[model samples]
Target: MMKKYVCQYTIIRFLPYVETGEFANIGILMAAINQPYFGFEVIPSKHHGRITNFFDQLNKDTFRETVKVLRDELERVKDNIDFQTPNTSNYQDVAKMIFENIVANKETIVRYSDPRVLITNDPAKELDKLYKRYVERDFATKPHNDQVLEKGIREILQLNHLNKQFKQAKVGDKRFEVRFPFVKRMDGEPLKIIKPLHLRDKEPTKIREHGGTWWQKFVQLQDLNLLPEKVLVPYVGPLANDDSYDACESIIEKIRGLDIEVVQTSEESRILEFAAE
Candidate 1:
């Protein structure tokens, strides 16, 4: 029979304005009962989506500070678990104590939910499972997934030592604006704009619709004469089945017609070359 261990877990939340009673799930903490297993995962402020948007009306500085404090404290506790071999005889109590300690009542922006219990064979994987279930689910990953795609492209650029040349920017004239994840400016004017297009979808229509949104943005930018000298769009597409090929090709054609450069994500060389230039 496979050994099974019970774990106590809590969902970490950020309560920016306590009066509003609005709290966002920002992380998860877990500890195994009867076993020396403890782990945690917190959504980094940079990777946070809805929480950052929620902070718009609130103070960004306070949000970040609170998140850092919570993460730091969690890390400190987790390290102690590693240093001291938790007594197996009392580990069940230790797990509950730790969970309760973390969720204790406090006036801070950080808060935790009531303790929940689960049985798992792997503590590390279960911690990740809880984070995704509690944190990512609360944010709704539709657009968040698109942001994740853009984030990956950013990591690729940073790895190639070409990230410094571009920065997040709004490219448009005074009357209109569209945000691009990576942009190069010339004389304070939008010079080269690089955007990651996430076109991978279960349905082809959804893919085309997303592409159309960007296509319209490009058209308006060109009409305003604010279009960058060069636009590099690295897209992920051509779904596994044959049905998506036509939609993918059509969208690519539509984007390319605006005199914009479109590169499939598989073409890493092209992306690096565009950024390097």
Candidate 2:
């Protein structure tokens, strides 16, 4: 039997006002002493409505910026812990230091709940479980099919050693903002927008709606001349004889018509060729 390790974690909360003492759980931080594991997960900025509603006076842009800074700090702490060759302190001590440094003296009140201990074989998995239970439960409903597609696509990117090149990117003029899920970049190559189209919804209407939205955006970007020079869309074809597949096909055609590249996720050679170029 695999031995379970003890993991300590705290829920990070954002308090709009310290006097009122009300707060919203925004993230989680976990540390496993014996395993020497440290990690963190934060609520995405897109799902910050609860924070806004909780604090009517809060500046939404400022709050989001602050959260981004805090996340960067957390990443720095994780890197330090991971690369620490000759660590002088214990894991618990390092965890506490990270928590305190992040929460110390910011305009918005950020605090962590009392550290709680749990026994788990995989600390990272436990962190995700807790995050989904607490923070994600209050956020938007993400389709399970989309989640699976994202995971699968990420695996492909990782296997090809191209994961680091892809990142969230925004491209547009001041008047409009277009967010791409993944943008691949290399020193000498033009930016490549890679989006995994999720069209496996059970409802045909939903699939059509999703497709329509992307089609509209493509048209708008074309009109504005804001479309990227290279766009790669990976799509999983729908089930055979399914009406929804028709809608999915329509979207793929629309994307192709816009001069964007489309490839099946299974087309490893094609994807790697694109990545290499």
Candidate 3:
């Protein structure tokens, strides 16, 4: 049985006028002490209307730019803490500091309720749950299309009776490492690695960033000679004529150059054939 870890989280809010004390929940930050997990999820783009309504005089562009800057800074802090690199403070303290920095101005108010604790097998999923509960009004109606590719791959594995043979695997040496989504073993030795790449994000920038990150990892693994022999990348191809499509294509080409197999999620027959082997 997997151990359940305790997580503490706070809701990030925006205050247009500090004196008025009126604010809106704009994002969430979560962290766990015993685990190296920390992340932030922001309100969806559709929620901009709530901000504008709350602060009739606020400039939408300025608000967006501020949020972007805050997110970038928070991500930088998370990276340092996650990697266990040299940092001035501990993870929880740094999280609180970043939150304070974001809400320091009069236009933005960052206030978190008393920290709430929860036990979860996956901290990331718990963060999503909190975000949906506090931030997304239409959470129930939203489709979980982001997980479609992964679900499909898992289904194929189960259908082929290969689910028991595969487990999550880690690659790389002590200096750096990455967890492959799934790995199949033959006689207790890793035989193949499976990675699911979802390239159908609504934002082109997200698609580009995801592709670039994976490409960099592939390069790193190649340099370290840690590239698996029968690696499989299951991808959800982006819509035609969209920039995301181009981004996905570029990543596919790079992975293929390394002789790793790339299979489209829509290619159900091909996926099953690969899994059967």
Best by TM-score: 1
What digit string (tens of lDDT, one per residue) describes model 1 on residues 41-104?
A: 9988765546666433555666677778888888887767666645556655665677777789
Clashes of 2: 0
The candidate with the higher TM-score, 1 or 2, is 1
After best superposition, candidate 1 residue 81: deviation in angstroms?
Answer: 63
- TM-score of every candidate: 0.50, 0.47, 0.48
Candidate lDDT values, in order: 0.76, 0.70, 0.67
lDDT of 2 by residue, 134-164 (tens): 5675333323545566677777778988889
How would you encode candidate 3's per-residue C-alpha lDDT over 1-277 as one tens digit per residue? 8877677787776665454344566788887654456788986544566667445456787567757766786788778766763343475555555544543443445565556678899989989888886666322311244346667788888887877767777676654455666777777656777777876755564455455556666676677787668777878877787756776787689878888889877787876666667
The order of the candidates by TM-score, greatest first, is 1, 3, 2
Q: Any idea what lDDT model 2 has?
A: 0.70
Task: Spell out the clash pairs found in candidate 3.
Answer: 15-109
Candidate 1: clashing residue pairs, number: 0
Candidate 2, which segments miss by more than 4 Å at Cα?
A: 1-144, 185-190
Model 1 scores worst on lDDT over the 10 consecutive residues at 48-57
Query: Residue 8 in candidate 3 has what lDDT?
Result: 74
